[model samples]
Target: MSDLNKLGLAEARDALRAGDVTSVELTESCLKAIDEADALNAFVHKTPEIALERAKAADDRIKGGDAPSMCGLPIGVKDLFCTKGVPSQAASKILEGFKPEYESTVSQQLVDAGAVMLGKLNMDEFAMGSSNETSAYGNAVSPWRRGNDDAQLTPGGSSGGSASAVSADLCLAATGTDTGGSIRQPAAFVGITGIKPTYGRCSRWGIVAFASSLDQAGPMTKNVRDAAIMLETMCGHDPKDSTSAELAVPNFEAMLTGDIRGKKIGIPKEYRMDGMPSEIEKLWADGAAMLKDAGAEMVDISLPHTKYALPAYYVIAPAEASSNLARYDGVRYGRRAQLAQGDGITEMYEKTRAEGFGHEVQRRVMIGTYVLSAGFYDAYYNRARKVRNLIKKDFEDVFAKGIDAILTPATPSASFGLGEMTEADPVQMYLNDVFTVTVNLAGLPGISVPAGLDSQGLPLGLQLIGRPWDEGDLLNTAYALENAAGFVAKPGKWW
Candidate 1:
């Protein structure tokens, strides 16, 4: 038999149902893989005891014929999700040793569906940076590398550990949260499938907040079908989160019939940025051609505000982040700093925050604070909100014109070295989110499907943005693209 850790979520589900394997066996396989792949830094926390306990219970439930699709599947939870008694640090020093008393709504729902928790995965500090370099624990390295270069690469940011774990086969599938391009970008970098549901599709109640308006929880998996299965388990209505959509969750896997005939896919002409690599342009064109052959009609469209998405997103996200991150003071949970002899409350606050936050988190908080400051609010924050509305309107106009989903390159390039952009201007790192932020800004569902490999043998992905509250349709289109693209490449195991 093949290694159990190599099984995808869907495959594991089918195997469990057929009595060919038990949840405990799968959980053990993943735990062993997690141990062997420690150098990858995918999992920052390991819950072997809890995982086995849950797996045993899952075996009972499956044998009793009361199993859900996710029953007996082992999954890695992103640190952003508050798992009860497990450290939910959001990859920041300020949140170090903080464990929530209550479970995150999304994670609890997955547990209720019989999914076993492998552990908490690493991520960018407070989900702030575009590359995984901002993580306080250290960067989660991508499994892929340039041909014989042996230099480590990044697995993308915020959800980097989630992407790394899934791509490295450290876990069957993992949870990821997207604010800006966290989920999709990392997934693209690691050659996997990841989807960000419509903004309110997944509840945000227990997940650590990073830009309250843009943060959303979704799954990072090895393939499109596994993404469908995991996403179905992660979404639902929660009264605790005012932003949670009140729609009924559908069987997303059932929607993946791979029939996109007569569906209209829009190609925004504005995405063809100057100096784009020929490989990316060729990959995008090839993806469109595949969809066309699969019977999806290609229509040229434009999102006029595309050029402004990155700037507007930077302003709006930081502004919201400043507001949401204010709760982390010395008085509350998590880490606190030792006071100097003459330090006052003001000094304590300054000292605690300075010591607790990573450099990137501090930068974002400063930028956020500046934008929302009294004199600059109108010039930066408010203006950015207006631009955000225009960006949303652009997408609305495209969808109104009968575009089922918009197709674009998931990232400008494939995975790069971990410290490649860290030395340059921060704006260079921010540009990594250009293709994905608009989806978050517009509160639309978007997915990244691995389409092909770049010249260096690194993976490249294509993105599909769908109408609000229309993830089912978006997923179906991604399924068709996945089938037509037929990208099954995996990184050679060097970790």
Candidate 2:
């Protein structure tokens, strides 16, 4: 009973069905663990009362034999999601105390499936930074420390809190949104499984807007199977989001046959970045070898536009972000700046924005504004969009040649110390997404599976990018990698 919080989603689902445990008990166990994990700073908003209430209902549903796979399983919601009446801040001060009146589409879908929401998790402010340091709630520290060094490490950003909460056993799983690798990079840093579904597969309605075209919600869980179960529930067509795909949602958990034999796995030479860590290089090679053992044919491939992906992503994401974030002025809601005597409307807007946004958020908004300005619109934004199309076409060309899945390292390196890269050039931090931005740029499905440990015993992950609308096949391939790698390392209970 005490260890119910540590159980994965599938394990808890089975335990609930078998009558060995109750949802209320599991919820209590998780709430207790979260209370003890303040040092991790993973869960920024605690909703124990709501969690227990949902758990009681789940128990009733189970008694009626109407439980879904996620019924009663305690999980965290990323702050980017607007849970009705819950503070959906997106971890930025600008939106501080701003609770949404309506629930985000993805979260509402999970509630319909009966999953319990423990609370809102922390993240990079507006999902901007690679490291979790940009979060206003403070860094969501990784549970895995450097080898006996006691240095607090960062659980990767944007989805950093989701990764930390899942890895630390504070929750069974958590919701994560990926825009330029927010979900996968952090999952890699913290040793969890996170998937960014094909763009438009998950409705963007009600989610706090960042780069609207690039944002997609997915699940971060303890294993590939758990991700499959949660992803199915999180995905569906919503009329509110014009970009939502009108397609049937598949039972992703049932499709995890782990039989990826004869599947074509593309190994892109462009992913082999200059000065990439030797350990990551070796880990990627080892992942390829394991897939070969599982009967996956590995073939060398090229995505020529890969070199321009990072630059193009930076330009385009900020441009969209600037446009989407303009509504946060003090006139509507959220924090308002104190006005000086006789200040005008322009002054009020300027003061509110300058005082509200953090360095990273402000930096992005400024860059976005500059790029979208009349003089630079064609020079930067339009050119970046063109490059983005070329990048997408590159993946299409590969898949046209029958590549079932593309394999790459999830991040350039393992988790780093909290403030190590934040003080340096911001590009040093942006480089963390080198291996991941291409996936988002192409609007494809991607997953990060914990593959192995580095020399310091910290976990590293391998990424699998799949065809558009083919997450079932993508997850199956990741399932094979998960089995082959057999990465079962857990961070010691330091938090």
Which is the leading candidate under lDDT? 2
1-495: candidate 1 lDDT, tens digit per residue: 459999999999999999999999999999999999988999999999999999999999999999999999999999999999999999999998898899999999999999999999999999998778888889999999899999999999889999999998989999999999899999999899999999899999999999998999999999988999999989999999999999999989999999999999999999999989999999999999999999999999989999999999999998888888888887889988999898999988898999999888888889999999999999999999999999999999999999999999999999899888964599899989989999999999999999999888999999999999888899999999999988999889987
lDDT of 2: 0.94
Model 2 deviation from the true structure expressed as Cα RMSD, one decimal place: 0.7
Residues 239-270 of candidate 2 have per-residue lDDT tens digits of 99999999999999899999988999999999
In model 2, state the lDDT of residue 11: 94
The C-alpha TM-scores of every prediction are 0.99, 0.99
Provide the RMSD of all predictions against the true structure, rounded to 1 decimal. 0.8, 0.7
Candidate 1 segments exceeding 4 Å error: none
lDDT of each: 0.93, 0.94
Model 2 residue 389 distance off true place after TM-score fit, in angstroms: 0.5
